[model samples]
Target: MTADDQRTAADLLDAVGPAFGKLRRTALLEVDNPISAKDLSRTLVLNLVLEHSSHSEVTVGMIAELLGSDPSVASRMVSDTIKAGYLTRAASQQDGRRTILQLSDSGRDLMTRFRKHQRDAYDYITADWSEHDRLELARLLVRYVDSVAALKERSRTKEGDQ
Candidate 1:
């Protein structure tokens, strides 16, 4: 890309940071429970377990990698959730030595309610938008997230090769 094009792209991408920060703050304020950063991290881990537990194992190490957090921090978060009855640990069927994480009934319920709150919040925010525009925004946001994930993976691969 040309210099000006690169600069413009950087500027556009930079704006997304604050926009997401605002969205996160608003969502946290709307949630029934006061969630700390660690709690949010654990909740995301629960989300992953809910989504993928049937197909694969979810472990603390995997959560740490996904959250870009230290493994110890992830472990502590997992432990806290376990103590809260939001998650459970079981020996992995495929690997006896490895422990897998699963969401408890309460965790599932929490996630369900959280999802509704998020949808309601977004719907209210986009009340003036046409259905098509809302759909397009969702599509584009998913594309953006997938692209960024791919970029991160590629960067990690490059670092590993070095």
Candidate 2:
């Protein structure tokens, strides 16, 4: 990569975590939803359940692994979200004895509004940018997320072997 490209990469690495942390901490997190999440972790649990439920059943154990937290922490977060009416527990189809998590109807609505708030924020932030530049940034952001997911998977596998 060129020196400019190297510098840009470094800058991106430095900015991503703080930017996302701030975004999650923003008012947009509530998104004027009827159900109020206790904190950022509640929202994260909802998002994680939504993201993983398509291909895998979500459970407290899964959330703990994904969040890199103790199972007790994830269990408490899940329990709180459940009490807030954003998540529900059900028996896993594959294992009747195992419990899985699913988003409540209200949780789905919150996510829909959350996505809209996110898009509005992105448009407002990049209002001065050209369409091509905006699209490129969107693409790059998704790519970065995919890269992080891949790294997480690899790390999980390595941990399993030890």
Candidate 3:
């Protein structure tokens, strides 16, 4: 990489850690407006189910794998989310022995409101930025997250091939 490219990457790496913590704190506090989420794990579990349901079943194993968490920890988080009435676990139809996750109605409602709060927060935070810049940042952020997931998946596939 060029000197400038290397510097840019270094700057990004420096900013990422704090940025993620700030995002979690902001979501927990400000985003609690319409409907408060119990915790970050609750939000994450619901989101994972929502995102993965179209393509595949969501299980505690999937949650643990994707979150890079221990299976027991993922199970506890899922159990807590279920206790809060935001998620439900059921026997998988294709594999009755496997438990799959689905969002409850309350979960769907909370997510809808949660998204609105996120958009509001984004607009408010970026009030000084140009509309084009704000939209570009949103797009780039999603692209970045997808790239990270793709890389992790590639690593997992390589490990499994060994």
Candidate 4:
């Protein structure tokens, strides 16, 4: 990126920082119980599970891997979700000892509502942008995420080697 582009990017980041902070605060305010002050992270995890996993069984390990979290953390989240009436666990048909998880009806309903809110929020934020701008933003965001993932993998490899 040119110096002008870098400056513009920095300005954009600076402008959006407060917007995200406010959004995070607003989301927490919406929740009845602020469990561990991790509302945003939990919501993201729930979204991942709902989006990637079919109504079919999904393993705790898969969720953990996808979220780049420890298995115990994912297990705890699953347990909490189950307790909250959002998820159900059953014995895996493939492995009797292994548990498989699926979202309860309540979970699906909750996700649908959250997704609608998310879309509306996103749309409002980008309302002024043209379709081409929206598509370019989407493409760039994907590339940025991919690059960050690669950097994370490299860091993990370095840590493992040491």
Candidate 5:
């Protein structure tokens, strides 16, 4: 809460920004299957679909809303994913006018590897932490993430009211 504490936190973030970039590069490089950064965006779209959708089916509109992307952008990414054999789309049974997307086997395989890389990254980041400290950090991180999400929601609501 003090000015010194605020400055130290800001300084830490500035110092860690490049470290975060390096870690992301390292993790992406560690993936078993090679995927270009450009291609990874579509893969991320498919991953979100798997994470949030039920029956393994997601609509373009749903993806757009979840990602805060335009419907056209989500549609294009879906098409790209399908072409890459990471996802497939079918006519929605509930609503014939809408399309539903499902992740293909390759997509699932990629996600598995991605998860492993993420675990490794987290492990590396916490290598020096004691068990108790690790647990406390995890708890704090969860709370921080939740608070940020709530703040984002409040900001959106405030914007809407203006």
Candidate 6:
């Protein structure tokens, strides 16, 4: 890329950082319970389990990988959530020696409410947007994120090679 292209790309990516921060703040404000970043992280892990995982069980290692966090940090977050009655740890059905996490009833309830708040926020923000525009935005945003993730993986592989 040319220097001008690089600068423009950096500027655009920098703008997204603050936009994401604002979104995070808005989400925290919408939640009824006071929560720390760790709590939010745990909630996100639970959401991933609920939405993405086919087995409905996740290990701390999986959480760490998903969150791009250290195992210790992920473990702490998991422990906190478990203590708060948001998650339960049990032996994996496939392997009794392996442990997995699942959301508790309270966690499910919290996620349901959180999802509604998120949907409401999106509806409000896009009230004037045509349905086609909304769908296109969602599709493009996911594509952008996936592209960034792929780029990051490539960078990591290059670094490892070096």
TM-score of each: 0.75, 0.77, 0.83, 0.60, 0.66, 0.67
Predict model 6's lDDT versus the native. Answer: 0.77
lDDT of 2 by residue, 1-162 (tens): 555465677797888788788765664544443234454457789999999999999999999988989999999999998998989999999999999999999888877876776777677768898899899999998998999999988988999999
Ranking of all candidate structures by their lDDT, best first: 3, 2, 1, 6, 5, 4
Reference-based TM-score, model 3: 0.83
Best by TM-score: 3
Ranking by TM-score: 3, 2, 1, 6, 5, 4
lDDT of 5 by residue, 45-108 (tens): 8778886676445788888887898999988988888898888888888888988888789888
**Candidate 6 lDDT, 33-80, residue by residue in tens:** 445566566677787567545755689898888788999998888888
Q: Give candidate 5 regions above 4 Å deviation.
A: 1-39, 55-57, 146-162
Q: Which portions of model 1 miss their true places by more than 4 Å?
A: 1-11, 31-41, 152-162
What TM-score number comes out for model 2?
Answer: 0.77
Q: Assess the local accuracy of residue 37 in candidate 2 as a C-alpha lDDT between 0 and 100.
A: 41
lDDT-wise, the better of 1 and 2 is 2
Alpha-carbon deviation at 16 in model 6, angstroms: 3.1
lDDT at 94, model 6: 82
Clashes of each: 0, 0, 0, 0, 0, 0
CA RMSD, predictions in order: 5.3, 4.3, 4.2, 6.2, 5.0, 6.0
Q: What is the lDDT of residue 4 in candidate 4?
A: 42
Write the residue-wise lDDT of candidate 1 on 111-138 in tens digits. 8866776677667777798899898988
Q: lDDT value for candidate 1?
A: 0.79
- For the record, the alpha-carbon RMSD of candidate 3 to the native fold, in angstroms, is 4.2
Runs off by more than 4 Å, candidate 3: 1-13, 31-40
Better of 2 and 5 by TM-score: 2
Candidate 3 residue lDDT tens string, 1-162: 555466777797898788888786664466335345465558888898998999999999999987889999999999999998989988998899998999999889878877777777887778898889898999999999999889988998999999
Instruction: Please list the C-alpha lDDT of all candidates, in the order they appear.
Output: 0.79, 0.82, 0.83, 0.71, 0.75, 0.77
Q: Deviation in angstroms for 25 in model 2?
A: 3.0
